[model samples]
Target: MTAAQFKSNRFDLAVDTISRADLEEVIAWLRKYPRLTMGEESKRFEQAWSKWLGVKYSVMCNSGASANLLMYAALESAGRAGKRKVVVPATGWVTDIAPAIQFGWQPIMCESDPVTFGLNMDSLAKILKRDHPENVVLVHVLGVPVNMTRLLALQKQYGFNIIEDCCASHGSRHQGRLVGTFGLISVFSFYYGHHMSTVEGGMLCTNDEHIYHHLLMLRSHGWLKDLPAADARRIMKKYRVDPFHAPFTFTIPGFNLRPTEISARTGSIQLRKLDATIRRRVANHLIYQKRLNGAVDFARGIPGDVISSISFCAVAKSAAQRRKIIETLDKKRIDTRIFTAGNLGRHPFWADRFGVFSAPVADKLYRGGFFLPNNQSLQGTDIEYICGVVRKALE
Candidate 1:
């Protein structure tokens, strides 16, 4: 914890996943075609992402938050706003919940499962029984896939639309299939600290063609130009507009959330390395689990679920122990963080409007959850050292 410790190279929670070669690849693309914007490169990246995730369509956007916004907006546009309520997990980034509320949808906060750090079925069942919400924003919290088998069954019974927030989960799988493919629409973040990097970008993936067409329009300025020629023509024919005016036509209200050619080009290069990056992350996570076994309390994927492990998490038995552990790790030159925005409902933004609802599991996470470094850069030795620090702190 001393100043000298700070000067040393610590096992930080995130190392830049984007390599120099990836940057050079982007530069090469730019140099080859200097006129860069969200065009061919963006389309190429979107196609690659769709193929990787096994989805019919993928739309690249400026950030994950924008992806969420467009997803919710697409739902609202599809006329689900009448139900007005959506179930959200207690543990996840604010953006996951914010866009829902911003779109005038009521957010029913559900408690987290200590095992998955996602919406616990018990709590979610209770919410579903009570509210019968038409939508559920499911976050694969920190790359640990939710109990999708159970959740999907519930979804079938309840008839709620599912939006999988895979913003932090690039390669995570549930039931042997990718996480994003399970829901109607899924999002992924390629920010600097995520599983991969586009410097700043995100993606929305879906199998639904209508949603896909809407997403294409929504990512841009809600114009017909981004849509498929047939789809755009249909809209034009319906509105009685000429081709000249079609370029300037605005359909649904939207924002320009498009990513640049640079981001997309960089993402295309980064995508090539994603599998290796995920393998290293899994390796480090296993090391953390083996080393920190019995000392920490956090979720791990079951047999059919695979975690990308953006950062390995450890939950202390008590709030005091959690604080001590964080301070101790800092002294040892290790980086730690609260698990992904811990209990979005506990934050002032939601609490002020909703009047402080209680979610025991999320509250437990808010008080005790902390993350350890787990990324492509971390070696087995580094993971061992970090775990040793954690063990000492717990002691």
Candidate 2:
């Protein structure tokens, strides 16, 4: 490809999904001089997110990484983190497993699935059988729904709690059910490039009331101020605390991972357009899949699942081929990156402490995976053009 051709078409790996109109909405809200901290707006966003996600409760936090931390904290606070041994995926982001290490939990890494690039069921089964972990954390890698059918069956058989990281998998579904709804607690990111943007925000969702209460306390300074009135009163009475001091009472150790009213306001605005954004991304992803079929290998996902991908991840035949394709994409002015962490196990964070995790699929992804643009801004033709660039590079 010529440099002139590169200047003609530019494709970004991530285009901010938050529109000018959405910013206008935030500006309007700001002009009202509303409360800008975690208040009514945050509550509204949480409720809206819960309703949309088909979950009973949702807690908004500063970032998805914090949400992951809170998930581990809540699990321990609620006495649900048995043995503190968790099964984490080798293909997911580091934060998915970092919290385990931070909490001094024993994290057993599982291999990536060949089809969905999620946790390999056979590998997870092996972990469950041998390790008997208390929890299993899985990411719907790049918006492709994991094999939830097999995963759920394994959960039933192994009796392990499930925590899902749906940060990049918004609107993805497995067997007509949403990805986040299946886990004991699921986390979502509303970062700038995701399906929606709250500037820097995330949500922790769950149907368990006890866990929900624990999340409220864990989100703040482990205080009862954010808890429901009845629950707070019950806690106060149990501890023989006075009403004056109950609100400030620290229940369990927590952090100030609170979202600002501005983020919450933006989230409310972005939430309105989330479904539309998801539809566009999903459509664009399918176009990439169909066009790049045999030219490069990628996740096919399950037959009935929906993929609302943040980026289309493709695996070249070899590391050399991947380098060539990335070079071509760069020359074409198309933004691309190595697949999300490729293998967290190979990263220094994990490798320094534990030896390199070697598995066929994970190692292959580590060497060959690359991300292509897939955002709400791209259309079918854009995807086709990108695929053509990749196919030509392969040739």
Candidate 3:
């Protein structure tokens, strides 16, 4: 397509990473009348995912939210979820914190950092001193890598397990390390319009062997069927159960969050093109940052870190300015939306439980943060044009 023709089309906040060719592959596989349930395809996708993310194990689930739920459940099942006091981010999707609340953990809301838009280290340190929480969940907000250098130092001192919500940050890196690799258990989403699409799916990844075993059982029905044969045999010996009844044996209380073979097959196909997608997104994001610099505020992230942003998030000077910019974007046929959840604390789900989470950076993001298109579909020219529209709106 010509550049002008492409620009004439709607500039979306996200675009499906899956192409017609990918769908054709899926269709061809469907003709085989293969097992649609979680089977070999799911295993292959998980293995491919683990290798890509540099993790030892990966568990595919129904959705990213399901992966978050599995992370909490895995912690508890492994007997490592101490105190049930988990620190959650103020500027992330609700799922980042909701699982903590649903799992009956005391959720302490942390402020957003001015630069990275992830957890504010100062706020987290204060919480560590005060609440003494055992776990902290953070999102690489909008694919901007959190300041893991500081967060990891805090983890060492305070000794809290890190649960990274990388659902929107598939290829983000901090200090040359992948975001998901830093956490005890990290989650990624493969829903439509994300880094990639499996139609609907998520992945839970970890390096710890014990946590890996628990994730395998918890992803299904807490049965030994999915567990490694060696692990299953050991468990059976411990319970004095015979091999005949082992597969049906229940271990920990689990949920049915299995991904279908179709989704898994789609995921494997999408994974192949993910690196190219990341490259295009990274280039587009740089264009946004360069052209819009000083004209608007956005997460700068830590220096030297790679940001594989899903969308180019910018904060207008005020709420009125944001409305004006968004209006301009809409008029120009560009898609835009308020930042992810604004502040999760402002939502009724959180407000009803613990009063509005008030903080300088987070409240500002709630009032002024907005998203701009930064998917793999957009080119440098498209981003520059979008930036021009935004800058004109600000004037």
TM-score of each: 0.96, 0.98, 0.98
Write down the lDDT of every candidate, Cα atoms only.
0.85, 0.92, 0.91
**Poorest lDDT segment (10 consecutive residues) of candidate 2:** 1-10
Residue-wise lDDT of candidate 2 within 1-395, one digit each (tens)?
33223433578788787778878878877898998878999999999999999999999999999999999999999999999999999998989998899999999999999999999999899888999998999999999999999998998898999999999999999989998999999999988788888989999999999999999999999999999999999999999999999989998898999999999989988889999988998898999989999899999999989999999999988999999999999987898899999988999999999999899999899999999989887777778888899999989
Candidates by TM-score, descending order: 3, 2, 1
Candidate 3 — which pairs collide? none
**Residues 7-87 of candidate 1: C-alpha lDDT, one tens digit per residue:** 346776777877777777777766776657788889999999999889899999999999989889888775655577888
Q: Can you write out model 3's per-residue Cα lDDT over 284-381, one digit (the tens) per residue?
A: 88888899999999999899999999998999989999999989999988899999988889999999999988999999999999999888778888
Q: What lDDT would candidate 2 get against the real structure? A: 0.92
